[model samples]
Target chain A: MAEQKQVARPLSPHLQIYKPMLTMMMSITHRITGVALYGGTLLVVWWLAAAAHSDAYFAVVQGFFGHWFGKLILFGFTWALVHHALGGIRHFIWDMGRGFKLPTVEWMVRANVIGSILITVLLWLIAYGVKS
Target chain B: MNEMSNASNMKTPLKRVRGFGASKTGTEHFWQQRATAVANLPLMAVLVWFLIAHFGATRAEVIASLQNPIIALLLIMALASACWHMRLGLQVVIEDYLHSHLAKFAALALNIAIATSFFAIAAYSILKMSFAP
Candidate 1:
Protein backbone atom coordinates (compact mmCIF):
# COMPACT_ATOMS: atom_id res chain seq x y z
CA MET A 1 0.00 0.00 0.00
CA ALA A 2 1.20 3.52 -0.78
CA GLU A 3 1.47 6.06 2.05
CA GLN A 4 -1.33 8.62 1.98
CA LYS A 5 -0.18 12.22 1.87
CA GLN A 6 -2.10 15.03 3.54
CA VAL A 7 -2.99 17.90 1.23
CA ALA A 8 -3.53 21.51 2.29
CA ARG A 9 -6.53 23.26 0.83
CA PRO A 10 -7.27 26.93 0.48
CA LEU A 11 -8.63 28.45 3.64
CA SER A 12 -11.44 30.97 3.84
CA PRO A 13 -10.74 34.48 5.07
CA HIS A 14 -11.26 34.67 8.83
CA LEU A 15 -10.44 36.98 11.70
CA GLN A 16 -6.79 35.91 12.04
CA ILE A 17 -5.13 37.02 8.76
CA TYR A 18 -7.09 40.17 8.00
CA LYS A 19 -7.40 43.39 9.95
CA PRO A 20 -10.69 43.59 11.84
CA MET A 21 -13.29 45.67 10.04
CA LEU A 22 -16.21 47.51 11.58
CA THR A 23 -18.71 44.87 10.50
CA MET A 24 -16.63 42.09 12.00
CA MET A 25 -16.18 44.06 15.20
CA MET A 26 -19.90 44.70 15.34
CA SER A 27 -20.63 40.99 14.85
CA ILE A 28 -18.29 39.94 17.64
CA THR A 29 -19.56 42.68 19.91
CA HIS A 30 -23.09 41.45 19.29
CA ARG A 31 -22.17 38.00 20.60
CA ILE A 32 -20.27 39.36 23.61
CA THR A 33 -23.12 41.67 24.46
CA GLY A 34 -25.47 38.72 24.05
CA VAL A 35 -23.49 36.81 26.69
CA ALA A 36 -23.56 39.90 28.89
CA LEU A 37 -27.30 40.21 28.33
CA TYR A 38 -27.78 36.66 29.57
CA GLY A 39 -26.17 37.64 32.87
CA GLY A 40 -28.11 40.88 33.00
CA THR A 41 -31.39 39.00 32.55
CA LEU A 42 -30.56 37.04 35.67
CA LEU A 43 -30.17 40.30 37.55
CA VAL A 44 -33.61 41.35 36.32
CA VAL A 45 -35.10 38.08 37.49
CA TRP A 46 -33.48 38.52 40.88
CA TRP A 47 -34.97 41.97 41.21
CA LEU A 48 -38.39 40.84 40.09
CA ALA A 49 -38.37 37.82 42.38
CA ALA A 50 -37.33 39.92 45.30
CA ALA A 51 -40.11 42.32 44.59
CA ALA A 52 -42.54 39.43 44.39
CA HIS A 53 -41.26 37.58 47.47
CA SER A 54 -41.61 40.13 50.21
CA ASP A 55 -41.00 43.67 51.33
CA ALA A 56 -37.81 42.61 53.11
CA TYR A 57 -36.40 40.96 50.02
CA PHE A 58 -37.26 43.94 47.89
CA ALA A 59 -35.68 46.28 50.43
CA VAL A 60 -32.45 44.28 50.42
CA VAL A 61 -32.21 44.36 46.64
CA GLN A 62 -33.09 48.03 46.44
CA GLY A 63 -30.47 48.78 49.07
CA PHE A 64 -27.81 46.98 47.10
CA PHE A 65 -28.79 48.64 43.83
CA GLY A 66 -28.60 51.98 45.54
CA HIS A 67 -24.86 51.45 46.00
CA TRP A 68 -22.33 52.93 43.56
CA PHE A 69 -21.02 49.57 42.38
CA GLY A 70 -24.49 48.32 41.64
CA LYS A 71 -25.20 51.48 39.72
CA LEU A 72 -22.09 50.98 37.61
CA ILE A 73 -22.95 47.38 36.80
CA LEU A 74 -26.53 48.37 36.03
CA PHE A 75 -25.21 51.01 33.67
CA GLY A 76 -23.04 48.44 31.94
CA PHE A 77 -25.98 46.09 31.69
CA THR A 78 -28.09 48.82 30.17
CA TRP A 79 -25.43 49.52 27.56
CA ALA A 80 -25.14 45.82 26.74
CA LEU A 81 -28.88 45.48 26.40
CA VAL A 82 -29.26 48.41 24.07
CA HIS A 83 -26.21 47.46 22.08
CA HIS A 84 -27.27 43.86 21.68
CA ALA A 85 -30.85 44.84 20.90
CA LEU A 86 -29.76 47.06 18.03
CA GLY A 87 -27.36 44.40 16.85
CA GLY A 88 -30.26 41.99 16.75
CA ILE A 89 -32.13 44.43 14.54
CA ARG A 90 -29.11 44.63 12.27
CA HIS A 91 -28.95 40.88 12.00
CA PHE A 92 -32.66 40.80 11.32
CA ILE A 93 -32.15 43.14 8.41
CA TRP A 94 -29.34 40.98 7.11
CA ASP A 95 -31.50 37.92 7.51
CA MET A 96 -34.03 39.57 5.23
CA GLY A 97 -31.41 39.37 2.47
CA ARG A 98 -30.34 42.97 2.69
CA GLY A 99 -27.51 45.06 4.19
CA PHE A 100 -24.68 42.95 2.76
CA LYS A 101 -23.61 45.69 0.36
CA LEU A 102 -20.53 47.64 1.39
CA PRO A 103 -22.23 50.93 2.06
CA THR A 104 -25.21 49.44 3.87
CA VAL A 105 -23.04 47.19 6.07
CA GLU A 106 -20.84 50.09 7.06
CA TRP A 107 -23.81 52.33 7.71
CA MET A 108 -25.55 49.66 9.79
CA VAL A 109 -22.48 49.16 11.93
CA ARG A 110 -22.22 52.89 12.54
CA ALA A 111 -25.93 53.04 13.31
CA ASN A 112 -25.77 50.14 15.75
CA VAL A 113 -22.90 51.70 17.67
CA ILE A 114 -24.29 55.20 17.68
CA GLY A 115 -27.84 54.12 18.40
CA SER A 116 -26.77 51.94 21.30
CA ILE A 117 -24.79 54.74 22.89
CA LEU A 118 -27.58 57.19 22.32
CA ILE A 119 -30.19 54.91 23.86
CA THR A 120 -28.00 54.09 26.82
CA VAL A 121 -27.43 57.77 27.44
CA LEU A 122 -31.11 58.48 27.12
CA LEU A 123 -31.98 55.64 29.51
CA TRP A 124 -29.51 56.88 32.11
CA LEU A 125 -30.84 60.35 31.81
CA ILE A 126 -34.39 59.15 32.35
CA ALA A 127 -33.32 56.90 35.21
CA TYR A 128 -31.49 59.70 36.99
CA GLY A 129 -34.17 62.18 36.19
CA VAL A 130 -36.79 59.94 37.75
CA LYS A 131 -34.56 59.50 40.77
CA SER A 132 -34.32 63.22 41.23
CA MET B 1 -25.94 -10.55 10.08
CA ASN B 2 -25.35 -11.73 6.50
CA GLU B 3 -27.73 -9.07 5.13
CA MET B 4 -26.10 -6.37 7.27
CA SER B 5 -22.64 -7.33 6.00
CA ASN B 6 -23.90 -7.20 2.40
CA ALA B 7 -25.42 -3.75 2.96
CA SER B 8 -22.27 -2.45 4.59
CA ASN B 9 -20.16 -3.75 1.72
CA MET B 10 -22.43 -2.03 -0.81
CA LYS B 11 -22.24 1.39 0.92
CA THR B 12 -19.62 4.05 0.12
CA PRO B 13 -17.52 5.80 2.79
CA LEU B 14 -19.26 9.09 2.13
CA LYS B 15 -22.56 7.50 3.24
CA ARG B 16 -21.37 7.88 6.84
CA VAL B 17 -20.96 11.63 6.68
CA ARG B 18 -21.98 13.36 9.96
CA GLY B 19 -24.44 16.03 9.04
CA PHE B 20 -27.64 16.39 11.11
CA GLY B 21 -27.59 12.66 11.96
CA ALA B 22 -30.57 10.32 11.42
CA SER B 23 -33.02 12.39 13.46
CA LYS B 24 -32.78 15.61 11.39
CA THR B 25 -33.17 17.75 14.53
CA GLY B 26 -30.73 20.58 13.89
CA THR B 27 -33.11 22.60 11.76
CA GLU B 28 -35.64 22.56 14.58
CA HIS B 29 -33.25 24.61 16.65
CA PHE B 30 -32.84 27.06 13.81
CA TRP B 31 -36.57 27.29 13.33
CA GLN B 32 -37.25 27.80 17.03
CA GLN B 33 -34.71 30.61 17.31
CA ARG B 34 -36.28 32.45 14.42
CA ALA B 35 -39.77 31.79 15.72
CA THR B 36 -38.92 33.14 19.16
CA ALA B 37 -37.28 36.22 17.71
CA VAL B 38 -40.41 36.92 15.75
CA ALA B 39 -42.52 36.40 18.84
CA ASN B 40 -40.19 38.57 20.83
CA LEU B 41 -40.70 41.39 18.37
CA PRO B 42 -44.19 42.01 19.70
CA LEU B 43 -43.56 40.82 23.24
CA MET B 44 -40.66 43.20 23.60
CA ALA B 45 -42.73 46.13 22.49
CA VAL B 46 -45.47 45.31 24.95
CA LEU B 47 -42.95 44.74 27.70
CA VAL B 48 -41.26 48.06 27.10
CA TRP B 49 -44.52 49.92 27.02
CA PHE B 50 -45.64 48.20 30.20
CA LEU B 51 -42.41 49.14 31.88
CA ILE B 52 -42.81 52.74 30.85
CA ALA B 53 -46.37 52.82 32.12
CA HIS B 54 -45.26 51.36 35.41
CA PHE B 55 -42.14 53.48 35.57
CA GLY B 56 -43.49 56.14 37.85
CA ALA B 57 -45.98 53.95 39.62
CA THR B 58 -45.49 52.85 43.19
CA ARG B 59 -44.05 49.47 44.11
CA ALA B 60 -47.53 48.23 44.84
CA GLU B 61 -48.73 49.00 41.36
CA VAL B 62 -45.70 47.34 39.88
CA ILE B 63 -46.32 44.21 41.86
CA ALA B 64 -49.99 44.24 41.03
CA SER B 65 -49.31 44.57 37.32
CA LEU B 66 -46.80 41.75 37.38
CA GLN B 67 -49.09 39.61 39.46
CA ASN B 68 -51.84 39.74 36.88
CA PRO B 69 -52.24 36.17 35.69
CA ILE B 70 -52.03 36.96 31.97
CA ILE B 71 -48.94 39.07 32.30
CA ALA B 72 -47.31 36.59 34.65
CA LEU B 73 -47.89 33.69 32.30
CA LEU B 74 -46.68 35.69 29.31
CA LEU B 75 -43.55 36.66 31.18
CA ILE B 76 -42.80 33.04 32.05
CA MET B 77 -43.25 31.88 28.48
CA ALA B 78 -41.21 34.77 27.13
CA LEU B 79 -38.38 34.13 29.57
CA ALA B 80 -38.23 30.44 28.72
CA SER B 81 -38.28 31.07 24.98
CA ALA B 82 -35.73 33.85 25.32
CA CYS B 83 -33.38 31.56 27.22
CA TRP B 84 -33.84 28.81 24.67
CA HIS B 85 -33.08 31.25 21.85
CA MET B 86 -30.01 32.50 23.68
CA ARG B 87 -28.70 28.95 24.09
CA LEU B 88 -29.21 28.11 20.42
CA GLY B 89 -27.59 31.32 19.16
CA LEU B 90 -24.69 31.09 21.55
CA GLN B 91 -24.10 27.44 20.71
CA VAL B 92 -23.78 28.23 16.99
CA VAL B 93 -21.43 31.09 17.83
CA ILE B 94 -19.20 28.94 20.00
CA GLU B 95 -19.15 26.15 17.45
CA ASP B 96 -18.23 28.54 14.67
CA TYR B 97 -15.57 30.55 16.50
CA LEU B 98 -14.02 28.42 19.22
CA HIS B 99 -11.53 25.92 17.80
CA SER B 100 -10.18 24.53 21.07
CA HIS B 101 -12.21 21.57 22.17
CA LEU B 102 -11.58 22.06 25.88
CA ALA B 103 -12.42 25.75 25.76
CA LYS B 104 -15.54 25.04 23.73
CA PHE B 105 -16.69 22.44 26.22
CA ALA B 106 -16.22 24.86 29.09
CA ALA B 107 -18.06 27.62 27.26
CA LEU B 108 -20.90 25.25 26.43
CA ALA B 109 -21.14 24.18 30.05
CA LEU B 110 -21.13 27.78 31.21
CA ASN B 111 -23.82 28.75 28.75
CA ILE B 112 -26.00 25.81 29.80
CA ALA B 113 -25.58 26.54 33.49
CA ILE B 114 -26.42 30.19 33.01
CA ALA B 115 -29.49 29.36 30.94
CA THR B 116 -30.71 26.79 33.43
CA SER B 117 -30.16 29.11 36.37
CA PHE B 118 -31.95 31.96 34.65
CA PHE B 119 -34.87 29.74 33.71
CA ALA B 120 -35.20 28.52 37.26
CA ILE B 121 -35.03 32.01 38.65
CA ALA B 122 -37.66 33.26 36.23
CA ALA B 123 -39.93 30.35 37.00
CA TYR B 124 -39.55 30.94 40.73
CA SER B 125 -40.23 34.62 40.32
CA ILE B 126 -43.38 33.88 38.36
CA LEU B 127 -44.59 31.52 41.04
CA LYS B 128 -43.78 34.02 43.76
CA MET B 129 -45.62 36.74 41.96
CA SER B 130 -48.64 34.55 41.33
CA PHE B 131 -48.90 33.69 45.01
CA ALA B 132 -48.12 37.11 46.36
CA PRO B 133 -50.91 38.99 48.13
Candidate 2:
Protein backbone atom coordinates (compact mmCIF):
# COMPACT_ATOMS: atom_id res chain seq x y z
CA MET A 1 0.00 0.00 0.00
CA ALA A 2 1.27 3.46 -0.92
CA GLU A 3 0.84 6.37 1.49
CA GLN A 4 0.02 9.85 0.15
CA LYS A 5 2.16 12.77 1.29
CA GLN A 6 0.73 16.23 1.96
CA VAL A 7 2.69 19.35 1.18
CA ALA A 8 1.99 23.08 1.37
CA ARG A 9 1.36 24.84 -1.91
CA PRO A 10 2.26 28.40 -2.88
CA LEU A 11 -0.53 30.94 -3.36
CA SER A 12 -1.51 32.02 -6.86
CA PRO A 13 -0.06 35.24 -8.32
CA HIS A 14 -1.92 38.27 -6.99
CA LEU A 15 -2.06 42.00 -7.70
CA GLN A 16 1.51 42.67 -6.52
CA ILE A 17 3.05 39.92 -8.65
CA TYR A 18 1.05 40.35 -11.88
CA LYS A 19 1.11 43.31 -14.27
CA PRO A 20 -2.35 44.80 -14.69
CA MET A 21 -3.73 44.67 -18.22
CA LEU A 22 -6.64 46.72 -19.47
CA THR A 23 -9.01 43.76 -19.34
CA MET A 24 -7.92 42.92 -15.82
CA MET A 25 -8.30 46.54 -14.74
CA MET A 26 -11.75 46.76 -16.27
CA SER A 27 -12.79 43.49 -14.65
CA ILE A 28 -11.92 44.79 -11.20
CA THR A 29 -13.64 48.09 -11.90
CA HIS A 30 -16.73 46.23 -13.04
CA ARG A 31 -16.91 44.55 -9.64
CA ILE A 32 -16.24 47.81 -7.78
CA THR A 33 -18.86 49.70 -9.72
CA GLY A 34 -21.29 46.86 -9.09
CA VAL A 35 -20.76 47.37 -5.36
CA ALA A 36 -21.13 51.12 -5.79
CA LEU A 37 -24.50 50.60 -7.42
CA TYR A 38 -25.69 48.91 -4.22
CA GLY A 39 -25.06 52.08 -2.25
CA GLY A 40 -26.55 54.19 -5.00
CA THR A 41 -29.72 52.08 -4.96
CA LEU A 42 -30.07 52.73 -1.26
CA LEU A 43 -29.93 56.45 -1.94
CA VAL A 44 -32.62 56.06 -4.58
CA VAL A 45 -34.77 54.20 -2.09
CA TRP A 46 -34.31 56.97 0.46
CA TRP A 47 -35.32 59.60 -2.05
CA LEU A 48 -38.39 57.65 -3.02
CA ALA A 49 -39.38 56.98 0.56
CA ALA A 50 -39.02 60.66 1.37
CA ALA A 51 -41.23 61.58 -1.50
CA ALA A 52 -43.83 59.12 -0.32
CA HIS A 53 -43.73 60.62 3.16
CA SER A 54 -44.49 64.31 2.50
CA ASP A 55 -43.58 67.40 0.55
CA ALA A 56 -41.38 68.65 3.46
CA TYR A 57 -39.58 65.33 3.63
CA PHE A 58 -39.09 65.27 -0.09
CA ALA A 59 -37.79 68.83 0.02
CA VAL A 60 -35.25 67.86 2.67
CA VAL A 61 -34.12 64.97 0.53
CA GLN A 62 -33.93 67.25 -2.48
CA GLY A 63 -31.99 69.82 -0.48
CA PHE A 64 -29.44 67.19 0.53
CA PHE A 65 -29.14 65.96 -3.04
CA GLY A 66 -28.66 69.55 -4.22
CA HIS A 67 -25.67 70.16 -1.93
CA TRP A 68 -22.13 70.05 -3.33
CA PHE A 69 -21.14 66.81 -1.56
CA GLY A 70 -24.49 65.33 -2.51
CA LYS A 71 -23.91 66.24 -6.14
CA LEU A 72 -20.47 64.65 -5.99
CA ILE A 73 -21.87 61.45 -4.60
CA LEU A 74 -24.65 61.48 -7.18
CA PHE A 75 -22.08 62.01 -9.93
CA GLY A 76 -20.07 59.04 -8.72
CA PHE A 77 -23.24 56.98 -8.55
CA THR A 78 -24.19 57.91 -12.09
CA TRP A 79 -20.74 57.05 -13.42
CA ALA A 80 -20.70 53.75 -11.57
CA LEU A 81 -24.13 52.84 -12.88
CA VAL A 82 -23.16 53.60 -16.46
CA HIS A 83 -19.80 51.86 -16.18
CA HIS A 84 -21.26 48.77 -14.60
CA ALA A 85 -24.10 48.60 -17.11
CA LEU A 86 -21.69 48.81 -20.06
CA GLY A 87 -19.46 46.22 -18.43
CA GLY A 88 -22.48 43.94 -18.05
CA ILE A 89 -23.22 44.30 -21.75
CA ARG A 90 -19.64 43.36 -22.57
CA HIS A 91 -19.87 40.28 -20.36
CA PHE A 92 -23.15 39.35 -21.99
CA ILE A 93 -21.49 39.49 -25.39
CA TRP A 94 -18.68 37.28 -24.17
CA ASP A 95 -21.21 34.84 -22.79
CA MET A 96 -22.54 34.53 -26.30
CA GLY A 97 -19.08 33.05 -27.15
CA ARG A 98 -17.89 35.95 -29.28
CA GLY A 99 -15.36 38.79 -28.79
CA PHE A 100 -12.61 36.47 -27.56
CA LYS A 101 -10.06 37.79 -30.07
CA LEU A 102 -7.45 40.12 -28.57
CA PRO A 103 -8.40 43.12 -30.67
CA THR A 104 -12.09 42.65 -30.08
CA VAL A 105 -11.62 42.20 -26.32
CA GLU A 106 -9.46 45.30 -26.16
CA TRP A 107 -11.99 47.27 -28.12
CA MET A 108 -14.75 46.10 -25.78
CA VAL A 109 -12.71 47.11 -22.75
CA ARG A 110 -12.03 50.55 -24.19
CA ALA A 111 -15.67 50.93 -25.06
CA ASN A 112 -16.74 50.09 -21.53
CA VAL A 113 -14.44 52.73 -20.13
CA ILE A 114 -15.00 55.51 -22.64
CA GLY A 115 -18.64 54.75 -23.33
CA SER A 116 -19.44 54.94 -19.61
CA ILE A 117 -17.77 58.32 -19.23
CA LEU A 118 -19.38 59.74 -22.34
CA ILE A 119 -22.86 58.55 -21.37
CA THR A 120 -22.48 59.82 -17.82
CA VAL A 121 -21.31 63.21 -19.04
CA LEU A 122 -24.05 63.41 -21.62
CA LEU A 123 -26.71 62.46 -19.06
CA TRP A 124 -25.41 65.00 -16.62
CA LEU A 125 -25.31 67.61 -19.35
CA ILE A 126 -28.92 66.87 -20.17
CA ALA A 127 -29.73 66.99 -16.46
CA TYR A 128 -28.15 70.42 -16.00
CA GLY A 129 -29.75 71.66 -19.15
CA VAL A 130 -33.14 70.56 -17.92
CA LYS A 131 -32.56 72.03 -14.45
CA SER A 132 -31.89 75.62 -15.58
CA MET B 1 -36.42 -8.11 2.87
CA ASN B 2 -36.22 -7.47 -0.91
CA GLU B 3 -36.81 -3.73 -0.45
CA MET B 4 -34.15 -3.55 2.24
CA SER B 5 -31.72 -5.40 -0.02
CA ASN B 6 -32.40 -3.05 -2.93
CA ALA B 7 -32.04 0.06 -0.76
CA SER B 8 -28.35 -0.60 -0.18
CA ASN B 9 -27.57 -0.37 -3.94
CA MET B 10 -30.20 2.12 -5.04
CA LYS B 11 -29.89 5.91 -5.26
CA THR B 12 -32.36 7.97 -3.26
CA PRO B 13 -35.26 9.68 -5.04
CA LEU B 14 -34.15 13.06 -3.71
CA LYS B 15 -30.70 12.58 -5.22
CA ARG B 16 -32.26 11.61 -8.53
CA VAL B 17 -34.45 14.71 -8.45
CA ARG B 18 -31.58 17.06 -7.71
CA GLY B 19 -29.44 15.89 -10.66
CA PHE B 20 -26.66 18.04 -9.23
CA GLY B 21 -25.62 16.89 -5.77
CA ALA B 22 -26.26 19.47 -3.09
CA SER B 23 -27.94 22.87 -3.68
CA LYS B 24 -29.62 21.97 -6.97
CA THR B 25 -30.53 25.59 -7.74
CA GLY B 26 -27.41 26.53 -9.68
CA THR B 27 -28.97 26.69 -13.15
CA GLU B 28 -31.94 28.70 -11.90
CA HIS B 29 -29.61 31.26 -10.35
CA PHE B 30 -27.55 31.63 -13.51
CA TRP B 31 -30.63 31.91 -15.70
CA GLN B 32 -32.26 34.49 -13.41
CA GLN B 33 -29.09 36.58 -13.40
CA ARG B 34 -28.94 36.63 -17.17
CA ALA B 35 -32.67 37.29 -17.47
CA THR B 36 -32.41 40.29 -15.17
CA ALA B 37 -29.35 41.56 -17.02
CA VAL B 38 -31.26 41.51 -20.29
CA ALA B 39 -34.29 43.15 -18.66
CA ASN B 40 -32.15 45.92 -17.18
CA LEU B 41 -30.78 47.07 -20.52
CA PRO B 42 -33.98 48.75 -21.68
CA LEU B 43 -35.35 49.35 -18.17
CA MET B 44 -32.22 51.28 -17.29
CA ALA B 45 -32.64 53.42 -20.36
CA VAL B 46 -36.14 54.28 -19.20
CA LEU B 47 -34.82 55.06 -15.70
CA VAL B 48 -32.13 57.36 -17.08
CA TRP B 49 -34.63 59.16 -19.24
CA PHE B 50 -36.89 59.64 -16.23
CA LEU B 51 -34.02 61.01 -14.13
CA ILE B 52 -32.88 63.39 -16.82
CA ALA B 53 -36.39 64.66 -17.44
CA HIS B 54 -37.10 65.22 -13.77
CA PHE B 55 -33.77 66.71 -12.70
CA GLY B 56 -34.06 69.84 -10.47
CA ALA B 57 -37.82 69.63 -10.59
CA THR B 58 -39.85 70.52 -7.48
CA ARG B 59 -41.13 67.86 -5.10
CA ALA B 60 -44.68 68.12 -6.40
CA GLU B 61 -43.46 68.07 -9.94
CA VAL B 62 -41.39 64.96 -9.38
CA ILE B 63 -44.21 63.27 -7.57
CA ALA B 64 -46.63 64.12 -10.35
CA SER B 65 -44.30 62.71 -12.93
CA LEU B 66 -43.93 59.53 -10.96
CA GLN B 67 -47.69 59.44 -10.51
CA ASN B 68 -48.07 58.62 -14.17
CA PRO B 69 -49.18 54.99 -14.47
CA ILE B 70 -46.64 54.00 -17.10
CA ILE B 71 -43.73 55.76 -15.43
CA ALA B 72 -44.44 54.35 -11.96
CA LEU B 73 -44.99 50.83 -13.23
CA LEU B 74 -41.79 50.80 -15.22
CA LEU B 75 -39.83 52.30 -12.34
CA ILE B 76 -41.01 49.57 -9.98
CA MET B 77 -40.17 46.85 -12.49
CA ALA B 78 -36.71 48.28 -13.04
CA LEU B 79 -36.07 48.68 -9.32
CA ALA B 80 -37.08 45.07 -8.60
CA SER B 81 -35.01 43.62 -11.40
CA ALA B 82 -31.93 45.76 -10.77
CA CYS B 83 -31.88 45.10 -7.04
CA TRP B 84 -32.30 41.37 -7.56
CA HIS B 85 -29.56 41.37 -10.19
CA MET B 86 -27.25 43.44 -8.02
CA ARG B 87 -27.71 41.05 -5.09
CA LEU B 88 -26.82 38.02 -7.20
CA GLY B 89 -23.72 39.72 -8.65
CA LEU B 90 -22.51 40.74 -5.20
CA GLN B 91 -23.14 37.22 -3.93
CA VAL B 92 -20.75 35.83 -6.55
CA VAL B 93 -18.05 38.33 -5.59
CA ILE B 94 -18.47 37.68 -1.85
CA GLU B 95 -18.43 33.93 -2.36
CA ASP B 96 -15.22 34.14 -4.40
CA TYR B 97 -13.31 36.34 -1.97
CA LEU B 98 -14.60 35.31 1.46
CA HIS B 99 -12.72 32.17 2.47
CA SER B 100 -14.34 31.59 5.82
CA HIS B 101 -17.50 29.50 5.63
CA LEU B 102 -19.23 31.39 8.42
CA ALA B 103 -18.41 34.82 6.99
CA LYS B 104 -19.49 33.78 3.53
CA PHE B 105 -22.83 32.50 4.74
CA ALA B 106 -23.48 35.67 6.75
CA ALA B 107 -22.53 37.87 3.81
CA LEU B 108 -24.84 35.99 1.48
CA ALA B 109 -27.72 36.35 3.89
CA LEU B 110 -26.97 40.04 4.36
CA ASN B 111 -26.86 40.55 0.61
CA ILE B 112 -30.32 39.06 0.13
CA ALA B 113 -31.80 40.89 3.09
CA ILE B 114 -30.48 44.28 2.03
CA ALA B 115 -31.59 43.78 -1.53
CA THR B 116 -35.06 42.66 -0.51
CA SER B 117 -35.49 45.54 1.92
CA PHE B 118 -34.41 48.11 -0.63
CA PHE B 119 -36.69 46.63 -3.25
CA ALA B 120 -39.62 46.66 -0.89
CA ILE B 121 -39.08 50.26 0.12
CA ALA B 122 -38.67 51.47 -3.42
CA ALA B 123 -41.66 49.56 -4.68
CA TYR B 124 -43.83 50.76 -1.84
CA SER B 125 -42.79 54.36 -2.39
CA ILE B 126 -43.50 54.18 -6.07
CA LEU B 127 -46.92 52.70 -5.52
CA LYS B 128 -47.72 55.32 -2.92
CA MET B 129 -46.80 58.12 -5.28
CA SER B 130 -48.64 56.62 -8.19
CA PHE B 131 -51.88 56.22 -6.27
CA ALA B 132 -51.66 59.47 -4.36
CA PRO B 133 -54.94 61.39 -3.91
The candidate that wins on lDDT is 2
Chain B TM-score in each of the candidates: 0.74, 0.83
The lDDT of each candidate is 0.75, 0.89
Chain A TM per prediction? 0.86, 0.90
TM-score of each: 0.75, 0.88
Point out where model 1 deviates above 4 Å. Answer: A1-16, A128-132, B1-23, B48-61, B97-110
Q: Compute DockQ for each candidate against the true complex.
A: 0.30, 0.65
Highest TM-score scorer: 2
Across A1-132, the per-residue lDDT of candidate 1 in tens digits comes to 367786798989866988988988888898898777777777777877777777777778877776889778878887887787788788888888988999988998999999989988887787666656
lDDT of 1 by residue, B59-92 (tens): 5776778778888777777778778878877887
lDDT, candidate 1, at A54: 74
